[model samples]
Target: MAQNKLAPIETSFSKLMGVQYPIIAAPMFLVSNEDLVVAASEAGGVGTFPSLNYRPPEKFKEALTNIKSRTKKPIGVNIIVNKSNTRQEGDLKIALDAGVELFITSLGNPKSVIQDAHKNGAKVVCDVTNLEFAKKVQDLGADGVIAVGAGAGGHAGPISPLVLIPWLKSELQIPIIAAGGISHGGQIAACLALGASAVSVGTRFIASKEAGVDIAYKQAVVSSTPEDIVMTTRVSGTPAAVINTDYVKKLGTDLPWLLKSLKDNPMTKKYVVPLIHLMGMKALEKSATNPSWKTVWSAGQSVGLVDDILETAEIYRRLVNEYHEAKQSLP
Candidate 1:
């Protein structure tokens, strides 16, 4: 583990979360799976997966069980509150039954989620893009808030981390976890210095070996630079940062094309080139070899910093090393 010379990370998140590191794997939609979550937890960081990743309730329970059996460390489950495809009550029930340590809810009002999570003795962390929502969640009794500012992977905020974290700290009294174009430890240190309790990373983890994405997607992340990313509003009605793939480029002018892409590959299994043009469901009917070979994967602007496909443990170690060194360099 890398030594942290930045401000002492002695907050509720670090204390009760009980992980050696103060980082949390941003719960990616289909890319974060049981294996990925488990690997990250064991590596000393909180690993998260979206509850909607599992189609049926039974499959969701099974995934929870597998993750628990694989690692004893704390694990987080993300719930998309405003998403159309989710069965919120049922998914929350399953997560509580499975004994998850943290519940990160986004895209909707988090009051109900906080109540349910508190009932189950689990912590509730809500994703907020602005101080208004941050105050709402804090007043409603959220344990923590994930500040999804500019450069964030999925649905993101227009605000910069330099502005958002400090603003939220002034308005709210709860723990704040900063998210966005944070690819290296220096960014993590910067977040802490700006009053964040911890850091939430998505794109960086997506490049790790434990991430359940395809090789092509991994390559896109490795090969990309900050200039290759674009902020688009076509995915789910919110501004989302994604790799400027041809598919996304087409989405700039065509809705039918995007819908066809989703219906074709509902799960978005990987960022392979073949998957880029192939429909997900149609490809499932075909062989994996032919499908994965051709997909253009999605990643954030931070993908430009990824140089290799490393194990989650190695990534965690590198982050700690960088964080410690960055902290030292600060003073």
Candidate 2:
């Protein structure tokens, strides 16, 4: 189906993905479900979800089947190609056999994934934090690179999109897809102007109707300001941006000094994030009454831009409308 209320936004990335809009509803963990992916594709944008969201391996294929049955549009899946995720190869095999259109690789070398995906006529884009990694993936034959910046939700990079997007665009021949702190159409417009092929939006959609999180989680995304978002490596040992609820404030505080303390204490150093989850997040989530203090949720700095909950299709509609308005307003 096409976007009926607005004209299509064409870009090299959108054309490659066969989506009408120059947006990729970024693959999110825990929040993205089949409903969200289908809605995004039907709304004229590429929709994607993390393969890790499906557990027990069998369910992953079931998810792919469900999404494919619902929509014929091109869709994507996120795969963590790192050492910690032992299931990477298995997930990659299932995704390839399912004829997944695109693969978004993160954390580790995507060399093998790019080769296999391309052999199956699928495309691969790597999530790169810096120019060194981006250039390496391009040389490995990745179809594109997603420039993840500091303001991104999970394992965010050190650079800003303002620097990363243009830097990758100038240095790499492959398309550069900008990610981090992008929620609104104007922000998307700014990325395009900065030489991004398209913008991969993650956080804003967490509040959408199709996201399968608790209503309280969605509400947190809506009500929180940018100041409520903070970056800490405490939860997962990776620098990730998250909503700073009372629980995180109390436990995940002043991460640098705490990290220093943990590193010196060999007994606690190995335990770090997992030990904290066992001590804090798990306990609060199971027994707490205050919704804000119960669960730690991931969100980008764009939480400030997300003010309301809407269906995924509605979110795409409003974004396209806003993109046009922003473009027209520019001199």
Candidate 3:
């Protein structure tokens, strides 16, 4: 695919983000890296990686510099805005200074982040699971909202995109990026028709060549179906969608009362929750790096639609073609 080719589908979000396609390679934790981000941007969509992917502030700035050197296309960074993210402010400062123009805030209130981002001449988009949160972010001056509905990979929402996207569009003036159970061009077209300004794709990108996941994980995504996906709260304090490996299956779906209390109670959370979150992080890290399929593998219900591992550029091309074809087939 030609890097300069304009996408057949266009939207205000695409224009605002300076991308050809109204698509964002959702900032998948650990999985999204500089290579994937560059590939997605070069392929006409925006790409983002989690801020925590780079540990030290300096390292994160270095990665941002590298991404800037590679492509002029727009890219984004995801920040976990909750109390647990002790490095949030520092990371945001580094990214803003490094000229990152788009910030995606998740897992907490984005009001402060939105203010800072706007001050830096950047845009803030918040990941929201429900209408109330979506409206909250919009009121805070968010540039957009990503509706992370049920069936999305990683920490997913309980609502379905079928219901969430249109409702958010009807209620909010900001652009709605529909996420969940979207993999094919037909699904992208459907989302666009549903009043979404763009679509956020996660699981589908795991199979892309530029994704940093293990080859085994990519193959698992290709071979598995929606049945292989399960929701487990064991990986983190919150519910997350992960592949059902034997190891994952052995873990409980809910935390114990004590752990749950520590995770939820503000007073206890400061001391206890971080330790629990650390243990969970270690387990996930081991699973993602080790050779065993028994380890935790994250994927969404869209895994059923993924049939092959292809380059990120190729994936974008196919999606564009598929979207056009689907549109033509529509009555």
> How many collisions between residues are there in candidate 2?
0
lDDT of 3 by residue, 1-331 (tens): 5645635578989878877898899998778999999999888899899988877777888999999999998889999898788999999988888888799999888888899999988988999999999988898999999999899998899998889999998999999999998899999999989899899999999999888878888998999999999998787777889888887777767788888877788788777766766777777766766757458888899999999999998889888888988998998
TM-score for each candidate, following the candidate numbering: 0.85, 0.90, 0.96
The weakest ten consecutive residues by lDDT in model 1 span 281-290
**Candidate 1: stretches off by over 4 Å:** 1-9, 253-296
After superposition of all CA atoms, the RMSD between model 1 and the true structure is 6.2
Candidate 2 Cα misplacement greater than 4 A, ranges: 254-292
Tell me which of candidates 1 and 2 scores higher on lDDT.
2
RMSD of 2: 3.4
At residue 238, give the lDDT of candidate 1: 44
lDDT of 2 by residue, 257-305 (tens): 7665885587876556446433433433332223544567788999999
What does the lDDT read for residue 302 in candidate 1?
Answer: 75
Candidate 2 vs candidate 3, lDDT winner: 3
| Most accurate candidate by lDDT | 3
- Tens digits of lDDT, candidate 1, 1-331: 3333323345567887987788998888667888789878887789999886777789989999999999988999998775343488889989999999999988788777899899988999999999888888999999989999888876778899999999999988899999988889888889999999889988888778877766667777888898888875444434566677676566562335655466447475234223332343232222112323333344576786779988887887788778878988974
Least accurate stretch of 10 residues (summed lDDT) in model 2? Answer: 281-290
Runs of candidate 3 with Cα error greater than 4 angstroms are 1-6, 264-266
lDDT of 1: 0.77
Sequence-dependent TM-score of model 2: 0.90
